[model samples]
Target: MNSKFRALTFILFMAFLRPALSQSVENAWVRRPLPGMKLTGAYMVIKNDTNKDISLLEIQGPDAEYYEIHTHENIDGVMKMRQLKKLKIPAMDKVMLKPKSFHIMLIQIKKGRLTKQAKKTELTLIFDNKVKLTTETKLSKGPL
Candidate 1:
């Protein structure tokens, strides 16, 4: 009976602690689509509160036909957009995805996906550890 009680206690403890172990998204927003533009950008701040590093695998949303993790690199004095396979967030640290740095590229945006008025969009962030986080973003004029 003592062992069963201990197991139950452990389970309850983990259940309450699971959320703290996951990555948290903050300041998530997407750029307003320009006239006849098929591509736009999304920015956010991701915080990993867990003890272990987290790998960002992919991002998906219905606002765009596809999405990719991208970073700007200076190659030969020219800025280039490089597609990142996985972005790592160090334990107890935050990674900022912003313009001219690490950001999410929304390619082939669906027509009328965005408007002058801010609208909330759903974004699914997939991690290498099989953790999926669904975050909402408000369409904005720019990263700001």
Candidate 2:
């Protein structure tokens, strides 16, 4: 193909791919489970830059048997955790997944999947409207 034709093709391809990258996951971090423990927690920032709301339908971690979204609430001066069916991120906004707020629970994790040392763990973030994104979480013994 001619040089001009190739340049045009590249521009068209990039334009087709722009919308897919508008959403992003940032500051992804997962707590390393203690020895003999079967669970851990994960946190991240989910950004929705589109004009419509996005709902986080599910999360899948290879190191864990399952995952669930959770949130903590103050009830009568006591903190309680409840599992959330789904987490929503409004358009042009971001959802911060952290301790004492919206977070992910990695349940029944396989032994030795993560250690005390720092490691990179992959998790699949499933969203509504047929969106799925995978992000790597740095694993460590975090205080939160």
Candidate 3:
């Protein structure tokens, strides 16, 4: 009976602690799209500590008509960008959303917006299980 009670207590403790351990963000930023271009990409490092995998379902904007999770694939020695329905961040690990790897594509950007002059922006990440995490991203016009 004592062992059973201890197990139950452990379960309850982990449940309450899960949210605190769920997600953390690092080095989040948006790369300024080329002049007059309709698309640009954002990069970041997402760390997850929970025991379950988390799926990044969507990215909400500081300035964009829309967003998509995308990755570059090498096909026949040629690289192409493809949209992902969702990007998964593995449990107890981190995912780097970087240029030509995995990234958030900001589409149909508002003209003259998100320029380096703007300096910074906020992006709200919506994950599976309805978890939303918002982070400020620097607006940059440089490599990686």
Candidate 4:
């Protein structure tokens, strides 16, 4: 192949690689929950930049006693929640955790104090590869 032809082919390959290289977590935010509510849900979209499957293993927060991965399903016309062992996100895809769906269950609020006053709670999401992503979430009042 000529030098000009080879250079054009290389340029085309690099153009196709740009989108994959730019993949990242975008607009990751969770709503603040109401007071007296023992549990709250987190929702976010994860954009997979690479060509590999990612599994979300766990989520944790400092304000709660413990956190667990959960999914809401309609079984026999009744809405029920079950513990999720792991959440899987396909390559170049997005996973959304929303109300009445898959979500992170934050349980056991600290005693004797309302959640509204709490500050600087760290939400750590652990992936299957042991990659931990932390997001700071604030508590709010009202139903999610």
Q: Candidate 2 on 1-144: residue-level lDDT in tens?
A: 699999999999999987763678998989878789998899999999988999999998788888999998888989999999999999989999987788999999876787775479888999996789999889866663
* Per-residue lDDT of model 1, residues 33-84, tens digit only: 8878999999999999989999999998988999999999878889999999
lDDT by residue for model 3 over 53-113, one digit each (tens)? 9999988985899999999988898999888999999998999998879999898999778
Count of clashing residue pairs in every prediction: 0, 0, 0, 0
In candidate 4, how many Å is residue 98 off? 0.2
Better of 3 and 4 by TM-score: 3
The TM-score of predicted model 3 comes to 0.82
Candidate 3 regions off by >4 Å? 1-20
Q: Candidate 1: what lDDT? A: 0.89
Q: Of the pair 1 and 2, which is ahead by lDDT?
A: 1
lDDT of 4 at 65: 81
Expressed as tens digits, the lDDT of each residue in 1-144 for candidate 4 is 699999999999999877643234444444455657776666666666667888888777665687787889998999999998998888768787777787777777666433555543567888876777777654443243
**Candidate 4 TM-score versus the reference:** 0.74
The per-residue C-alpha lDDT of model 3 at residue 15 equals 85
lDDT for model 4? 0.69
Candidate 4 weakest ten by summed lDDT: 20-29
Return whichever of 1 and 2 wins on TM-score. 2
In model 3, residue pairs whose N, Cα or C atoms come closer than 3 Å (at least 3 residues apart or on different chains), thus clashing, are none
Whole-model lDDT values for every prediction: 0.89, 0.88, 0.88, 0.69
